[model samples]
Target chain A: MLKVTNDQVAGHKAGDGKLGPLIDDLGRFYKPLQSNERGSNELTFYTSFSTNTRIPGPIRRFFPNFYGTQLVEASDGSSLQPHLVLQDFNFGRVNPSIIDIKIGSRTWDPQASEEYIQKGLKKDRETSSLPLGFRLSGFQIYQNRELGFWKPERTFQSLSADEVDLLLRKFVSSNTSANLDLQPDCSFASIVYGGSTGILSQLLELKAWFEDQTIYHFYACSVLMTYEKEFVSNGKIPCAEIKLIDFAHVYEGQGVIDHNFLGGLCSLIKFISEILITPEECTTEASPKDIQKNQIYFEELIK
Target chain B: MLKVTNDQVAGHKAGDGKLGPLIDDLGRFYKPLQSNERGSNELTFYTSFSTNTRIPGPIRRFFPNFYGTQLVEASDGSSLQPHLVLQDFNFGRVNPSIIDIKIGSRTWDPQASEEYIQKGLKKDRETSSLPLGFRLSGFQIYQNRELGFWKPERTFQSLSADEVDLLLRKFVSSNTSANLDLQPDCSFASIVYGGSTGILSQLLELKAWFEDQTIYHFYACSVLMTYEKEFVSNGKIPCAEIKLIDFAHVYEGQGVIDHNFLGGLCSLIKFISEILITPEECTTEASPKDIQKNQIYFEELIK
Candidate 1:
């Protein structure tokens, strides 16, 4: 039986009578094709991207391995519908910690309708995407073998600049609980994001491709970062994977650099790199006032 | 299309016009049921073991998670056949190294016919099983991102006692290639087999259960050991898994200890533990003559 993937930290989900992605026992993810132009566009993107010889072999590893498509029994009990068959990144993981960061300050494509552009612009401005070039759409952290998820109701659209950093800090903190507290322990930061094979290296690899290639412009796309919390907690070297997900709003770049995506990626990389350099003891001992002072200092530094 | 599982280290395979195990894209293992009593016996064992309240929950994790049965198109182009749908332990693994070790010095049960017992005894005596309590049925090791498998022709039936130890050590050595060389690097042994969450601890947990439970005697059963060579070589803690596989020859223990399986398990554990304790430098510097002398020392210690 197909099950709704609990580890999906963001994007559309299987609920409210809408067909969402379903994961099967064989580590295959079946994402139901939406009966709209968006679905067709995504299918087209995956198909073209798969066979595109211009895309280097090294860059291909950043995207999910698409196994074409299949017609499966729909989750909503509808007729057999075509679904994108992709690799389930969270498969065979134990207590995996995941974060979905929606990239780009502008989420709408150039060809988007005026109404769609306005809607996307409003969300981008309301979240950290405007100020920081990226926003935390959702995240789930496993602490002490228990999962603590970011509340859906929060939407994370109104987080202040400091709050955004706090969230990113909490994501790498081993002592942080589910309440999204700003904890002092950044012990897992270097292991998860700093090493040669860590998320930083993978994102930089993707950035290098985006810096030169003008193949596709990805709008409303997210960088999904995942690592096993069980391994991290046990003091094992964390093997982090970063994948670019969501392609409903992807469009041809027309030989232009995707500055929007590049900007957001650079911003996210800066935040992670800063976290790797920050002193754990300083964060551990900081009081609320000290944190406020530090925030003011950070804001001044950015200015 | 269903594919023959390439990662399966041993047992009846799909070749030779016979139905073998098939792995689906969803990471489910479909082991075809035999048309004889052996198939029915295995089915009964899984069905009963799944719901057997007498078995503790901890012990159940050692066996594959049974997802009932499925009727799929046969690999031999025959009609629909029932296959036991179990969790594919090797799913979602990158360059997984696997070994299938058939447990027990005596592989034939009391219920076997006289002719069958004699045949089993002859084979066991000829192999390492009679001398070392267990024998390597088959194995595949991943090195340098390439898979090197043990030759099927070799069968691994005639390995001497010291040769068995060398094989165990090679299994954990990162430098050992597919040619089954006696490498000195046991770098992955402590992480894969010695730690609290490693194979040794997991085996001890299973041994604890076998010491008390009077469930069934597993004749010709195998303990399948697997870990990701990619993770191990990358200096990540190897999350090794050990599963009790192949229940075709299982029989009711009738309120007695499963000493046959237990003894083999203990012997296997001892070999692994020895590998963990042996200094890496000692193995690295040892000559062929030194290894021969060490083999004699090990033989004397075992006696």
Candidate 2:
């Protein structure tokens, strides 16, 4: 029997007596397919993506390994529903820290309804998506066995560019559990984001693919980053992974560049790269007004 | 500088002042591409196979991970030569035992020249391939730290069906280094060929693909089986892998069944399955004349 996954830190999840994604013992995550066009679109995206010969082997690794779909009893005790079976990133890990950052300033497609576009635009503007071209949808840090999971409030989703940098620093900080008030040590930055197999390299590889690929325009899609928090405390080399997820808003690019997605990815890469290079600047406190100025300056620079 | 791999037990290799496949510190096997149609055909095959979306993800794992190609200094001190860079199966292993078994009774394709067909037929008839549909090209076993390596003479390639079974038995014999005279206990059979991830399961998976896939007809291809012999002695779980190699003779299937290759694969699978089920029969020695009768019987049975 599949159990509801408690580790999901972002996206549409079970709340208010609703059902959500399920996980099995075999390290498979079962995401209940939405019954609307969104569900069919996601299924279509994965189906095409899985069989898309144009995408090279390395680039294909960036997405989750799709194991087809299965009909399972819904978590809400409803009838059997078809679920997308995928490789669980947090499988076989102890005290895993996870973050989901939705890419692109324009989260809604041009073909979307006016209401949908308006709603998406409002959220995009309210969050870091407009200024930074990416927004932290959600994140959860496994501080310690005693302190347990630590996650910022929903308000954190509306962080400015500078606050987003601080969140990124906190995500990699090894000393977060020991001293909450202390600045981030960013000790796990090298293991989680640096090196040849690290998240930074993986993202760069994805960026290389997106630079030329005019196959798809990804809207409201996220880059989910995960790593074992226990590895940091134990001084063990960690296996950190970043996977592209949430393809419901994906659409065909029709031989044109996916500039929106490419821009967001590049912006995210810049922020992470800065955090890796200048860890001190990541945790440095700044006045609220100064943060607002930095946000405006960063947006203008990208523009 | 690339070094000639000492562990290669079969196929065209460095000998008699000739260059062969080279290995580097990065666990990559560099096979010097032939400056002929065969070279281009193989390169085409890999390029197509790598990007082939028709082949499912699971089936794709059976082939070697192709890393494009590189022009390296010819090992024979000639001009620059192109080489196919592939994942080395023997990489990062201690005391590895390896075997190369060329599949199919018909090793040459219909497109081959008369001369090539005649040469291939003679070799196939001389070996177990004609009688059993598969022939052992070569094998090398690491006996121990003291005994170093133990390999049969080239004459072993011409074994009858019964003798081939005996040879397969010898492969899984853990006591070979300790007592060469004793019959094989077949101790490593389950570890190397049993379980879900074992060679048997992997071969079955390949067989499943071959059953339906009509994209290409593989001729003169070899299934390379490798495992760390030290694991058997140390009681550690062994990681055994079976990879399809040598793609020079491949041809377009054109929607026709690859019966030649499939037959050989099934024959090989039958032999291994028997070894796993009845270890006692695997070690049972018969008279030379009786072995000859078994060969004729087996040939007739397959026909």
Candidate 3:
């Protein structure tokens, strides 16, 4: 069952409930594609919006349906409770190695924030800043970096302390260029690995979504990840078993630039770097020369 | 410009003009796709029913744009018109070597039956029969085998005598197993080459379309081809210059057999074989054993 959203989780209603707007936008965008003879069938309901066929064979089973809405009375006694209907989507063929995890703006637990992410922006304002007009409330973390088991109705589960430590150790050891030794403390590793990786997966999924389909996603939260489960050995977690999900707020167009999403992603990258090791050892440095070249290219294109 | 259907061309009006039925059917088929969120943007006005995008990249450039329609003065003196409008489509992009040929039930020319095709069932009953309730009037041909030029508004053109002869010679010579030699006469070559290749391309495209997109074309008659100009060596037409067009009547379903289209195609194939060589030398022979195996498989599945 999907986690229901209300004022308690975030200030806004679960944006997934905004499915109506999504449907309308898609209809409008696809309005011009009516044809009597020959063309693509990609725009139809099953192929376009639903994960039924669009999700590739390897990762499709995790997101089985766009299960419709549910109304639940908050534990805080906020609203009326009738029926909390859960939607199940038969996205595609099942892959046994799938452990779906959805994290984002909506998944942010207000009670647990002080320990997960510090308040305010980072020193480098741009990297830490959200994109203009984007709401942090809508941010989602999608990670498919680790393999997991195939279990439907799996909501976001926090990584165990040992799992986080094992993952961070794997990350540091894998990067030969970063000359950082594995930290001995599991407590610190959990904060860095569990928090940063969750956010990192969302960023990677966002970049990949654009590259694969040329579509940009605005509401990048509500992630679903899939992973293989058999790779677990000796308490060490493998780094390559995760996959992300959800593409409801994605759009297609020409020359449509995404500023906010990218800004948020970069911020996450920086945040992860800071938490994992000394700031000086971070490999995601944007060299002055690279920045200058991009500026020049942008100027030329504009001219 | 699109070839407008009217009383003069066939007993019924032009098929394209019957957009109402087409629209209705497509709407019904695609109505389930009316999702509020994720779906295809490919169904806008032109992309859904046209082969413009579905055609392989090798042949896409030849047919660009939904060229507007033309109004022709009815031979029956039905409409008072000073000018007949012809529709020209500017499909997206262009590649140089396209020689488009639309062939199928709709492409059957009224007066030119003798040189082209004679209406009769083939000796092989299976190839000429209709699939249960399917209508012959709805037959359409699809061809995108050859590469074509990207000039917009380029309609179908017949292959020249020299081009036809050259291509036939190539076909016969290329197949090492076929022990036939190229005939010296251009007229005989044209008859064999023109008639045989036209039907051959349709068959090739039908098989290819199913393999590529999983959509089967039932009325595979409207043919379009695109070929490179440089391939024409000294007036001798190259066998590689031909392609078929049209995919308007194709469908997406299971075991939806296309008997009439396949029958006509097989008949044309047989006709070509006869023209090219003695009936005994035809290489397209099907062993009874293969047919029996298919029959058994079908029976088992049905049972």
Candidate 4:
């Protein structure tokens, strides 16, 4: 029931600059499927599909901090579109603490500095020509709900001398291969909130550990769909509302929860590794390492 | 699921001796319903169905401990029944150091003693040869998969003096009337186990606290359900495999999650005052003149 949109929150902005393709140079990467002009205009195409489409594996993984992934049954079977849903998670819902971390702690936000912006722009040129966009409909700030939304980059909040050295040593590619199978003492179905007690979605999985007795088991599907849109405008806003119209097909579908879960969880691991851990201990600058030095930590606690 | 039967338990004698009626009486009190007995030669008839079908209003003054009262819900809807289940709450499940209280700590078990037996018989004779019946069932001692069927009543463990006094004090009398409620931190739900976990047919009215939210609001029912049954059978050596043949259309159907909640939470006031409180505390025992002298000096604490 929580509405997820830029309008419902504080601070808003739109892109006026052009973004060129950046991913083609990544070589051996994936290609996009061709699309045809929709029966309706682009704005309708974008809105109708984005909300309905199931989150993609890559995208879902990226937002590891999402509270509950409601697998709402999309009303349309033929429409290859994401399920239109209101999310409980909102990035703008942060502390705005303005506290500083030391250098080399998190991923560099493109909007953070001119150098990073240029680097990001160059990188985007390799990925795609169209501008990647996100907008907030609305958001409310709260207490315990604000955790896990902020993305840190190149900044260490407070690290001792040994901590910093140890972190760099860890990221030295010395521990590249390690077991990432350690399951967290977390429930599959969880309620993720913003900084405070903001109610997010409810997460439910097929065979999650919940009740005393283990009951029925069933197969499920994870699907994602995309839509094109026209210039977005909010009445008098600088741009026209980029309304999504079509929900044609899944970006990708028909996979197991484990695979999707792994991808999502792994992405979170990447985030933690990059933002929370030291660079020497991480493989990707975007996330924390997929492994841990101690597996017994969580197993014993759960037991 | 775990099960309990009078046959394997240590203390109870089955279908024989003078205690046969007593055991039968206990069983009837545990769970009572009429049998069709189509093939039997003898027919049983109600002696005072018209008069005793409804619990007298006066008993309501006692609350929680008066055993439950009934009012038939049929056209002759005078036979309405209430919910009040009991089970051996496995404290060891929380920790081995937790103490167990004797059945007679505050109020002596009327059924567990010889004097109660003699008095019950005399009262039954005076009251149409039938004691007022109750809809009770046992849920705690049953042996389930990992532990098998077991009993927890074997260890007739005595409560430490301090514990006894503390628990007694906890059943504080209300200002306006002689009623009771559990202390804030004392989530009494742990005590609602039967031979199996399902016997919580009594707590229908208090199901709201169990359905949702995550503070673990009242008590931890799942932990109570997961303890090792071995300790139970080792303790309640002479326990009985007791059950209710039919709930007789009772139960608000509060599912397994809500079962362990103490249904008659409000009724404890009477259970404490009438059954547990010393006769001297009531106006019945102390004379109007020297009642203060007759009362025992209240002790704050003892090392």
Candidate 5:
């Protein structure tokens, strides 16, 4: 009953020597039998599907961040096209202060790979090692219908050291208290991030998810950042939106405690802090010298 | 330590034979100790809390239906106020076409109580019988901030038999297909219900939830019907919005399949059909006779 194309089969094989395709078993690589599309199955699927298609209200409206994959019974017995019924996160309309960016493999720092692998092994005993890299592609930003909201290459290219540091600071403060746990004052955090209350809540949720590495098993996940530009007013940093997408290889367990997400998150935070965090100061604590280091780190990440 | 007042203790004990409160174990009943509020914990929580309060975007903007309860740790060891961070369902601004009405214990037919009790026992083995008359009072519509959106007594008193039939038909048609399941035509349904795509989605979701007896165990859940006036075009019948709320007693389990919701839904549907469905045709098949039956069923339910 399930029909898959030759190119899709090839792409799946190309992912790993014996590793399966990124998608879950419920999902299959679908190609339009009638149309002569040249791109990858995901690319073609995304391209052909119209956003105006009537997605169930719960999925389209409530669960905005994740890609909700639904199974439709094809009455005609003809093969159905595999396309994402994506919720529109109109950052330009919703919150103009935030700049959304999709970070993929290009953003994965090789220097921190060893650390990530070590952490992943310690957390997940069944699979004692992480994959070579998070196989998410930055170029796949075109998957979302909203144009210009996420231009990873352009945004990263244009970013100065100070901008990245400011962005990182805002993200960190929102999720964590002065201590690791315990958000002492909810009012203060809400006040600090005046207009972008929605963005802050989103990031905090994503942070919570990332912390719970036991249940979530994301393979080559893409992290989307909706960074606040004017986060600081008179030097009080707020929060930004950081969410994971493309859960093709994501799995949930009843009580699986691990450091899969945390390891990756730590590696990322470390890499970003290396550039932004001064040798004398902690990542949480900001300093005058952080500006100069930000420039240095920005240049490194850009390269 | 968790501190509680004398009245709060009384309310908790009164819910069951020493079964501490109507709230889940994860939830504890709390009263604003200083306030002179003389309502149930839920009503007091809803009334005292500000809708404009900066609810985390996830709970506020996204996932509007479910009551997301969070534990706030008091740093000073001072008691934190237990209040609902409710998202406002502004029918006036959002969907002017719809009139929202909350149906509570008053809607439960005393005549049908015996049948419902037998049905409930056959479904859930653990809870062998239905709770003595779904103890939710329709008068408790004031539990929500925006008053009069759910004045069921007033709404029913004003509505004629024809109006009641029209509302029920719209709700049933939207949820169930002509043959039951398989809504072949999406566009037709969307066209019939204009503007409030979000409301339509919410009703569909509630319908699905009710259909699923395995997990959802809503004993005395309140039904909030957002009935549209122009449900039909040029006398053509269409669907409207109907959603369930007040998930105070709702529970989920792997194998706890129950007929609590189904019994209520079917009874209402059958009653509506008796009034609307003529001997000559199916309820799905529209006819002028439906108008006649609508009046009859309206009186039956009201009585």
Candidate 6:
């Protein structure tokens, strides 16, 4: 019942729509975050703000968010390079002095593009020429590389206050003493089931209430899903990973860079929002006696 | 061990010979956050950065934060009004016509301080007041007879994704399935609880990795705290109630103004840091049991 941009829930309108530099109902419920991948092949970004949150005159667009680009070759093959994924990107406002949001790699990296995808697949080179579903929101994850991908990768200004008080007392005493699921001890990446951990030894899942160890905050909604093999297809699993492949209706939050990087921000959503939002809005409401004791594991992950 | 900033954590120098602004080592882990009694004793906020994260105005005076000037009592009881808290507020670069973060409100709400706290607290007057807090992260949540906490509060951009999915499905499934031991859902407030029933509703008491429905995301660290009446420490909670707090950890992320807001910019951490990086670094590896469980939860959050 809530795909609604306004049954007045907030689609609120009053006329000439009081336009002082606009935004009375800008795009109202956001017109599918508009995108043509803005001006050619894609990879655009521009936004800056933060004189301490006094936002106005603002009007933002950008949102398709991420998909393919990073074509570097450079071994003996020179430096193939291409990493594209741009469009609509024209940001501004949110500036601790235009501070670090960088993201203009112009492309290349898969361990230096695995020798540029093995010399463009041994010269068969189509390098997929470019352009399939470009989309992209604002992907700016850097790495000249040494080894990364387990999780817990700090450096958001190397953070400190004792690593934000050891990431909020190991995220509220990691469920009564060490049950941490995985992702943090970051030099970055390692997983054979929660590997090489150490930031707060991973267990946050996705917290959003007054956010972080709370006092007054309650605008909630969260996401962080990361799993890949390109996410699935030939044997299935894609369509936004079979519409949120029901990982037991996810919930784990306390913080350590939000339990190891919002699971890559839930693997770049767009499994067509898998029916926008449901598994009972990402589940979590047990009991009919634990929903009749987990009712066949919640009908086998909503089948 | 990282309270470092006089420079050197990776090589060790901060012998604290104090070249200034090591900020008493994150001020022995932050104590005074205060702001209750009628609020705004002019609260301060600091978070400087550089070493490419840019802040360089001679190391921005080593990050001095929060500048406030306080004294209030003017509901026309003749004067004592002054209040400021601006501090080193820079927003010069990262241009797009230029604005670099702004906020100069004489009134977004608080209509003339709700006609002076409702006709000046029935004429006892010394009232340069502000019971308005609940600015929904600067957007909506109001009620006035001269502000006396009612509870319709809206902000987080005046909620409406179906009142944030009917208040996260009535606080994560009907008052979190009528709380038994899981306690949490009264709207929550008393500083840093992690919203949506704070501390991320302890993942609705887990219920064994959220039985099947699957959608995982948890890793947060958003502390803003403001609530004091500890039975009457004589503190009146005001710094303008940061506009009437209620965060549920601000999450709506897909973009609709901070793109569904929730601590912005996360492209699945740029697709796993653009997938297992390595030119010479960002390779990441470790799983000795998640780096000995993040050094025993960073040694139990700085003990």
Model 6: per-residue Cα lDDT over B97-170, one tens digit each: 10000110011111124554235222211210111111112111111224322222221322211222222222
Clashes of 5: 2
Q: Considering every candidate listed, which one attains the maximal lDDT? A: 2
Tens digit of per-residue lDDT, candidate 4, span A1-303: 212122212211212221111111212111111234221222233343345344334233212121212232222222233222222222222231111111111112211345653463343223211010111111211112323112223223132222222222222211212222232211100111111211111111211211111111111111111100110111221110011111222122111111212122122222222323233232322233423323332233223
**Compared with the real two-chain complex, what DockQ does model 6 have?**
0.01
Candidate 2, residue A49: lDDT: 95
Query: Cα-based RMSD of the predictions, in order?
Result: 28.8, 20.2, 23.2, 27.2, 20.2, 28.0
- In angstroms, the error of model 6 at B108 is 17
All candidates: TM-score of chain A = 0.89, 0.90, 0.33, 0.20, 0.36, 0.18
Query: Quick one: best TM-score, which candidate?
Result: 2
Task: List the DockQ of the predictions in order.
Answer: 0.01, 0.01, 0.01, 0.01, 0.01, 0.01
Residue A288 alpha-carbon offset, candidate 3, angstroms: 10
A1-303: candidate 5 lDDT, tens digit per residue? 433211121122212222222232343432222222222433333332224243333222223333534443222343343333344332232222232232221121212245563453233222211211121222211111233222233223233223433443433342322122222112222333224444434433443443332333334445554433233432544344444444333333222222234333333333333323232233323464754565464355334
Q: Write the per-residue lDDT of candidate 3 for residues A1-303, one digit (tens) a residue.
A: 223321111222334432111112111111112132111221332245454444455334222333333344332343433221222221222222222222221221112234332332211112111111112122121122352221112221232212222223333232211122223222222332344344345445554443233123333333322221122222434233233333333343222223223323332333334445542332212365533543443244224
Indicate the residue-level lDDT of A155 in model 3.
21
Q: Report the Cα interface RMSD of each model, rounded to 1 decimal.
A: 30.6, 26.3, 27.9, 27.3, 23.9, 16.7
Tens digits of per-residue lDDT, candidate 5, B96-185, equal 123333222122221224556345323321221111112212221111123222223322323322343344343434332222222212
- lDDT by candidate, in order shown: 0.74, 0.77, 0.28, 0.22, 0.32, 0.21
- TM-score (chain B) for candidate 6 is 0.18
Docking category for candidate 1? incorrect
Report the poorest 10 consecutive residues by lDDT, candidate 6 chain B: B96-105
Error of 5 at B95 (Å): 71
How good is chain A of candidate 1, measured by TM-score?
Answer: 0.89
Question: Which lDDT value does model 5 have at A279?
Answer: 26
